[model samples]
Target: MAEEVKLFGIWGSPFSRKVEIALKMKGVEYEYIEEELGNMSPLLLKYNPIHKKVPVLVHNGKPIAESVIIIEYIDETWKHNPILPQDPYERAVARFWAKFIDEKCLPALWNSTWSKGKDREAAIEEASQHLNTLENELKDKKFFGGEEIGLVDIVASFVGFWFGALQEVSGLELLTEEKVPKLCKWSYEFVNHSVIKENLPSRDKLVAYLSARFADASK
Candidate 1:
């Protein structure tokens, strides 16, 4: 019997795109099922009942939720192209950065875009600090994973792509070339990566979507 792989995800979501990029990197063949947050599918609900979110990867008869976890699973299962590091310590570091990106950097940056008044100011400060931390981390390295696109690079894909688009829509200037040159350079490299570039959604479409969403949220 052949292995059956299916992914349920939203097209415009960075989280969903992350998993898709990982799958492409590992040369995994799978089915893509688009989902909407407003009208989430029953199968998606069953696969990820707790989160009720998209980017759910179903393998054979089992289901896995969470983009980071699913990417790790993809790396582990298909031993061809490794996304994480080989050494134990390096692997730990990769996981650490990935966690930091998801938990710290993304939330702060996102809040800075969506928030208002003092809250927005505070969020911008917090987000800038995190972005600086990432800048320092990428100071001398070609990629966060060093020389190649690895776990951290994959995980930080939003900072490289979506956040920039969001920045345009929100007009919040946190991730600038002067403020974080290393990160800006890294972003250029990350999105232009052949596999990653192919997997990304249309920038014009993404920007238009964010513009309308932000306008609606403001009103």
Candidate 2:
């Protein structure tokens, strides 16, 4: 019998899309199940009881939750296209940046869009700092993984696609070419990469979606 692979995800979620991108990069054939995040399905709940989040990957009968974990699992399982560095130290560095992107940068970036007054200012400041950190790290590299897309590039995929969309919807500017030119350039390169371009949600649709959501949240 053939091994079964299924991914439960939402269309607009970067986290979910990142997993999909990884799958595509590895030439992994899997079923894509779109989920309505607002209405959680029992299957999703069963697969990920703790988070009840999208981007759950089920291989055979086993389930994996969280996009990062799922991505690493896919990398390990496929082994055709290496997502992380082979060198131990390089791999560790990649992991560190990936964690930073998820835990620190994304939160600040998101808050900068929705927050107001002092909080908004603070968020923008913190987000800028985080972006600068990335800018320095990516100074001369074609990709975060150096010559090719790797763990850090995959993890920071949101900044490439959603950053502009979120900024447009919120009428905020966190990532400007003038401010962080290198990172901005990286964003352009990453999103325009053949594989990533194919998997990206339409920018106009994303802006429209986020506009309504942010409008409601503000009220």
Candidate 3:
């Protein structure tokens, strides 16, 4: 029997959008359930009781949490437009970068935006160093997986879809082409790609959302 697929996520969440993009790349049909973060639904609560986070993937009544893990599950299950590399070593490298992006780059980017003065500068330098490392890894490739959007691409959604909006929100110039030309180009290409372009939240909307949060945090 063909399994049913359902995804619960909020509109402005890049992590949630990562799952959407992964499913699109794999050509998997799913019911997209928009969750209200302030008033999370019982279904989301039930499935992800531990984290109570969005981007929960439920396939054949089984639930998977976390965007990267869900994308990996989708890659394994669908098997058509694959995300990970076939060879063990390449897959390991992909996983390493994915985790690095998540653990190191993402936090540094967010902190750079959320902090002030010297702290912000330090965060920007840290984020830039991480991006430079990724830039060297990418070299001249169009995508992280060398011609295809893969796991690393999914995890790097912050760069693809939200960097500009976050820049507006934080009033910072972090991911400019002058700073990281190749990564900047990849971000534009990834955002405008046919597969997941329509799924993106409006840049203005994200700016508004994050700006409000910054204001509240500043007060």
Candidate 4:
């Protein structure tokens, strides 16, 4: 068995938190090596030389980069809880949404935070629209991929955990119950799930960190 699993990541990063929650959900015991963002450890750079990003999953001797990829790898390797769906079509749908979150939804989230005046207003609208789509998709399901939190849930985790803090930091409200009611409920549920709750960073600390970072970025 490839028993040795080590994760290189920072606590505040949504990407890192996603991978950490995946491992925790799978009941996989692994070493958590917290990395300092600016002064990254050599192990991180050596393993993920191209991107030099955190949340790199090192299993046995091999390394996997990217949050979604690492999550998929963990699902395949662990084989217990089954994060991704077994059906091909269902799995494809899951992957599609996951990718959409990373490429489209997350960018809209950043734009909402990073831009100014009219641009910020536009970004909030764009993000709110995306949340509406996700809201309808979530509908009656407890999670994005159904009753149990699965691949898509992990991918959309940022909206659940981080974005609330981001909204507070930027003074932008895009995920209110009135805006995307289903998704708003889904976000609260996702973040408070037993496995997810324990794995999250402190809300106050996260907000303070984000507030400072956003303030710095705006300068």
What TM-score, over all chains together, does every model reach?
0.99, 0.98, 0.94, 0.96
| lDDT of candidate 3 over 1-219, digit per residue (tens) | 877999999999989999988888888889999999889999999999999999899999999999999988998988898899999999999999999999998999888888888998899889878878888888999999888888998899887778778887777886888878999889888888888687788888888898899899999
TM-score of candidate 3 on Cα atoms, chains taken together? 0.94
Model 2 alpha-carbon drift over 4 Å, by segment: none
* Winner by TM-score between candidate 4 and candidate 3: 4
Q: Summarize candidate 4's per-residue lDDT along 125-154 as a digit string, tens digits.
A: 898788888888887998997889999999
Lowest lDDT block of 10, candidate 3: 159-168
Query: lDDT (0-100) at residue 98 of candidate 2?
Result: 96
lDDT, candidate 2, 40-87, per-residue tens: 889999999999989899999899999889988998898888998888
RMSD of each: 0.7, 0.9, 1.4, 1.2
Which runs of model 3 end up more than 4 angstroms from their true locations? none
Instruction: Answer with 2 or 4, whichever has the higher TM-score.
Output: 2
Score candidate 4 by lDDT: 0.91
In candidate 2, how many Å is residue 126 off? 0.4
Best by TM-score: 1
Clash pairs (backbone) in predicted model 1? none
